[model samples]
Target chain A: MRTSFKPLAAGVGGVAAALLLWQAASGARAAGGSLPSVGSVATDLGALAGSPDFWSALAQTVGIALLGLAASGLGGIVVGILVGSFEPVRYATRAALEFLKPIPPIVILPLVVLILGPTGQMSWFLVFLGCLLPIVMQTVDGVHSTDPVARDTARSYGMKPVEILVRIVLPSAMPYIGTAMRVSAPAALIITVVAGLLGGGPGLGQSLYLAQAGGDYPTLYALVIVLGILGLLFQLGTRVAERRLLHWHESYREVAH
Target chain B: MDKLMNKRPVLWLLGIGTPALLLAAWWLASAGSTDTFFPPLADIVDRFRALWLFDHFGSDVLVSLRNLVLGYAIAALAAVAVGFVTALAAPVRWAVDPLIHFLRGIPPVALVPIFISLMGFGPEMRVASIALAAFFPTFIATVDGLRAVDRGLLDVAQVYRLSRRDRVVAVLLPAASPQIFSGLQVSLQTAFVVMIASEMLGPSRGIGAMTLLAQQSFMISDMWSGILLLGVIGFAANFLFDLVRRKVLAWYIGSRRLARAS
Candidate 1:
């Protein structure tokens, strides 16, 4: 217990030192003299904590991200499985997918906004596109990772293909799906913020942009702190989810230590 | 991945069939496009030919490439250097981990306004933002790669009394190349996205700026051309990256192939 406390104390000290360094760099005598102070930023955050608009913007971003995950997650898995299991479909789609996959998701944001207008739904659509590729690729990898011996044994027993897929295949693929979701969830949030900032869509990013435009440096800095906290929370949440969801997998077994 | 195993000559033609069909379908669908927003593909092609090929050599393309290549190259070198130090030194890792996470979580777009305020609407702002956006992924990947290197090999290096530089270059880097390269690929993707985003946010220059400008000016065909130009550049960049990755990882690939054969 005493030894572990040393590292924890060191971590706290490290973080404190970082804060001090930032404050020094952003202080009055700093090069530009335009940087936001840590104290003022914290005070502004305290003030904004009482505002409903702040909460709503936060909610809008998180809501769009969650919805985007839902939109892409299951369908992506099903499509990935289909593509992985089949030959012709995979081959035919390969060239097109390769061409489209490299095009950054932001490139299509304007196209979507132009077609759909700057709605929450539009933001969700953009997030969906942003997340689809990684999830699909990972899911396909998961499906392919299934043990052939297990599959052959199930086949020898004359198990129905549907039953085999549901029972054996799905369980095997769970670890990969968990990993994919972990990756996709963060991407969805980033895309949500991008949509909000650029497409005039609903989210914390919109609020962030507004604060910048309004010259509310304190507010701008505060919102970014809030975003950084939210990102950290999402990361922690996904990690816990991954641990619980993939407890049976070998990867999880290795991670447990 | 399964699609690549069977390398029949005729399969290549079959793979091309879908993209050709899709392009044809797009052309047919937009043949007489009355909508000002969705211009005909032919009109877009004409604009592309005029603005990019026949006109001023697309200087914006050069500007954008300069930003991307310069930013990405600097990021790759700096990340690997920093990652080596952080992974090897426990005190530094403990000291810097929280700071890294805090900075990394702030999305690249969020930094644009701040950078513009600091550096003004100039190439410096664009490059700084792009470099920053490209840095963290490669840094994290390199650290992970370094950490995953075999301690046995490291011990062997120490036992041999190898110089510190020799230890890293000969022992650590090769072991970490695969993961680091994967990180580089992700960094390039992030850089491309940030490059376009930074351009869009700015006083206008690159393909991204051009697209935004054309859209605002009601030059719909020009907007399509700009988007297409971005797509073409992105596709080419990815192809080149893959080629480089293949060359760099050839030894790793060969070993894996041998393992499979046996």
Candidate 2:
């Protein structure tokens, strides 16, 4: 207990020191005085916390991200299973998936923004695209990696194909799906933010851009802090959710021991 | 069963056929297009040929590439340097761990506004944003890689009375290179995305800026062509990075292959 407490105390001290350093730097005119003092930014953040507009913008961003992820999660798992179960389809799509996987979502940002007119729809579509391929790929890998021996044994036992799929394949693939979702969640949020920042779409990103344009440095700085904290929450949320969902898996079981 | 997939000819056919078929279908479908937003692929190709063949190539494409490469290089070097010190010093690690994790969570694109606020709309702003955004992944990877180095190997170096520089160069770096390279790949991707975001938000000079401008002005074909160029560049950059990673890590891969075989 004492040993663990030391690290926690050190972490808190570190954060305090960083705040102090930022305050000093701002006073010293770091980056030619554009940097806002930490105190002023925090005060502005407090003000923003009470604004209805700020809450709505935050909702828009979070809504786009969650809806995008949920859609992609459902679509990817279904498609991945269908493709992975069939040899021909898997081979046929492998090359195309590889080619498309590395292309960043930003490549299509302009086209979507143009078509959708910088709406929440545009942000949602971009986030969906950004998160879809990875989930599909991971799910496919998970399905493909199911133990052949278990499958063969099930076949010899005269188990129905549907039964085997439900009893064996899905359980085996759960960990992979969990991991893919964990990675995709943050990516979904980031894409939504980019849609706002660059495409004039609706979200906190647009708010940040407006503040910067208005020379509301305090508000801009405050919004950035909000975004940073929001991002941290998304990451932590997914990680905890993954662990909880995969508690029955061997990796977590070993940790329990 | 899966043998058909292993044949070189089948692999090549699928690889070449899929993209060609998709493009052919798109071309046919969009032909005689009346929709203002959806231009025919033929017109897009023509615009792509004119605008990107050499016209805006120097002005936009090269500028974006220069910024990306320079920023990525700066980030990779700085992260590795800082990572070494942080990994070696317990006090530094304790102080920085929570802060690092928090900063890493902030999406790279979100940093652009802060940078724009500081530096305004300039080339320096773009590069600075790209570099800072690209730094975290490599820094975390480097620290992990260095810390995970085998204690036995360090002991061996100590017994051999090796100089500190030699110990790091010979014993530490090669062992850590694989993880570092993976982090570099992520950093490059982050840098590329941030590069596009910064340009789109800015002084309007690079490929991204031009692309956004063309779309806003309703030059639909030109916009399509810009999107096409970006896709191609993104694909090519990844392919090139993979080639480099493969060449650099050939020895590590060979050993792993041997271990698996045994």
Q: Could you say which candidate leads in DockQ?
A: 2
Cα deviation of B129 in candidate 1 (Å)? 0.5
Error of 1 at B248 (Å): 1.6
Q: Number of clashes in model 2?
A: 0
Q: Give per-residue lDDT, candidate 1, residue A146.
A: 89
Candidate 1 lDDT, tens digit per residue, A110-213? 67777778899899999888888877777777778789999999999999999888988888988888988997887788889888877879989889778877
Q: Which stretches of candidate 1 lie over 4 Å from their true place?
A: A1-10, A29-31, A254-257, B1-11, B54-58
Q: Candidate 2 chain B: worst 10 consecutive residues by lDDT?
A: B1-10
For A1-257, candidate 2 gives per-residue lDDT tens digits of: 98788778888899999999999989999889989999899899999999999999999999999999999999999999998887566767888788888889998899998888889999999999899999999989988999999999999999999999888888899899999999899899899999998888898989988998888898998887788889999999999999888889886675532
- Per-residue lDDT of B233 in model 2: 82
Model 1, A22: alpha-carbon shift in Å? Answer: 2.5
Q: What is the Cα-based lDDT of residue A208 in candidate 1?
A: 77
Candidate 2, TM-score of its B chain: 0.94
List lDDT for all candidates, in order. 0.84, 0.90
What TM-score number comes out for model 1? 0.93
